[model samples]
Target: MSLKVECQKEELAEALQLASTASRSNSPKFALKSLRLGAESGLITVLGCDGEMWVERDLACEVIESGGVLVDAKFITSLVSAMPSGQVALELLVEDGMRVQQGSAEYKVLSSDPQDFPEPPDFGGEGELTLKFSQLQDALDSVLYAVTTDPHRAILTGVQVSYDGATLKLVATDTHRLAVRTIAQEGMGSSLSVVIPDRALRAIRSLPVGADDDVTIRFGMGRLGVEAGGARVVAQMLSGAYPNWERVVPSEFSRTWQVERDQLIDSLKRAMIIASESANRVKFSGSGDSLVLTAKSEELGEAKEEIPMIADNGQIEVAFNGRYVLDCIQQIRGPGIRFELTESTRPGVIRPAEDGDDYFCVIMPMSLT
Candidate 1:
């Protein structure tokens, strides 16, 4: 079928930007097969991707003819992005090829058989949950950093999502540390757990924000799909059992300290500057209402910074990888945070002081010896 379309150049460029980040394959064949087309509400939608992730953008069509086709993603995006700002004509040429013409420049893109491309999984069943865009983005941003990169431990490679009628929790861990963030929601279903790949969560967070519209997440069988802002994301769930994170967190602590978020972050950043050179270790000596951060390297001189803190109970000293602490604090947004500790060797619990029945993070300490 033949069709002509004209739309904003910036819109096409933005679509290409999103698709480019998710396309990591080397072979142009698999990368090009990621484009998809669908018709709805009198608009022609074009989607591009690299199989695991997909992005869809709609352009107004004259509807001289109505059908769907798939073309090489790289060629089409490169051509469209470089085209001059103005109306561009896209037509279906003979022998399964696409013709794009603008001004004096014209390019033909050969398309593959659309029938052979992989289709996104259809999430069946009426079961679904809704979450505000702000809340969902926060949860993803906070916990996704801790997801494991080890492919052999597949379960840790994804964020574990669990929902019970009243609250939804997102947890990620890499054995050494864990991040858990929970947000309150209404109309949730039975308690369900799904391991969503870190890549998929990041893609969802990239959606345009400030829209009051709620994102709908549908889960069934072995897949989870999210629909937000006229776009949809379908991702396969990681097949395995996530570690028992709750058991690893300490139930009781002997010492608790309250510290200013910015102060702690700044201290960690300075400590990491030196610790990063040496095995990335930073020592924390807790006593009374003060904490000392120290780092040393055999080749470089040692550095220490003392920050005032609000501590209860007795004294305890702990050592941790400075990079991990910085990563955890970067996710936390607030004026102050609370840290609970049982001993120098135990995992430390850090949470926002405001306390909204939200989530908390646990960071394991490194052995000093």
Candidate 2:
């Protein structure tokens, strides 16, 4: 028996986009690089995985027959994307392989054993929370940079996704710095928390979620799953407790300065060019109504920028990893960026300079030397 399904070329293209990232093209396990297609009553589901990340996207189509096939993700994706904006048909070959056809063009591609594909983890509970796509994506963009890239520090490579009764929060830290953002939403009445690999969080962004749509998150059976935008994603939870990031955030402030967001970023970028070759450190000195940014190197030279500021308190001097400050300010969209400092020895926060905002970053100060 052969599996068959017919779908619009654009529909197939969209579905392929959602599943393509799960392919590990260089993996020794060929099945891991393939897309698993399962056709049932009236819909066709495409599944892809790269061991750590997985995506399952459903495409609306006419299922001429009900069956399944696993084909190379790259090959199928290329074939589908090149097809005309019309209908396309996919069918399993008589003896082996699968065939894809559009108009006069056709291609037969080798297949993998469907059973060899690893299944997505079973997420059993009712959805725990629902968040708008923009909300989650916004928070992810702000905090993901702080996720550590060190392989040995596996726990720091994942973001802590948590929800209290009223807020959904994402927190990530790399010991040197921390990022936290909490968005107000209503969904699950109780609290829920999970540490999800940054890789998996990236895969969720690739799933077809639109900026305005809502994404539903469910947790159970040692897995976390999200359903939205015609796709469902489930991944195994990273096995470790995230650090207590709250303790690292400085609660009291000795000085706070408000500066134009674009101006600060521009000044930092110019300073970064010189700092990158040296210590990657940028020092901030705030006194009276102006903040001066200075970076120096023995080999490359130094850069000095004076930015107008509204310092609320004491004269302060602090040095921080310039890249860290850039990362935090780049995510903030408001007109003004706020810098709250307790001392040159503690972490300083960069946040939108508005009355209230959902995002904030705690960057540790570096020594001038």
Provide the TM-score for each candidate, comma-separated. Answer: 0.83, 0.85
Per-residue lDDT over 31-61 for candidate 2, one digit per residue giving the tens place of the 0 to 100 score: 8888999999899999989886688899999
Name every residue pair that clashes in candidate 2: none
User: What is candidate 1's local distance difference test score?
Assistant: 0.74
lDDT of 1 by residue, 1-369 (tens): 444455556665555555444454365566344465443445667665566555555555444455566666666777788877876666667674777777888888776555565665676754676777777788898899899999889889999998888888899999988998987766765567788888778877876545566787787867777766656677677888888899998888888878888999988898788898987889888877888889998877788988888888748878888888888877778777788888878898888766724767888898875
Superposed Cα deviation of residue 94, candidate 1 (Å): 6.4
Q: What C-alpha lDDT do the candidate models reach, one value each? A: 0.74, 0.85
Which portions of model 2 show Cα errors greater than 4 Å? 1-10, 40-42, 51-53, 62-66, 74-108, 185-188, 296-301
State in Å the error of residue 252, model 2.
2.1
lDDT of candidate 2? 0.85
Candidate 1, run of 10 with poorest lDDT? 31-40
Best by TM-score: 2
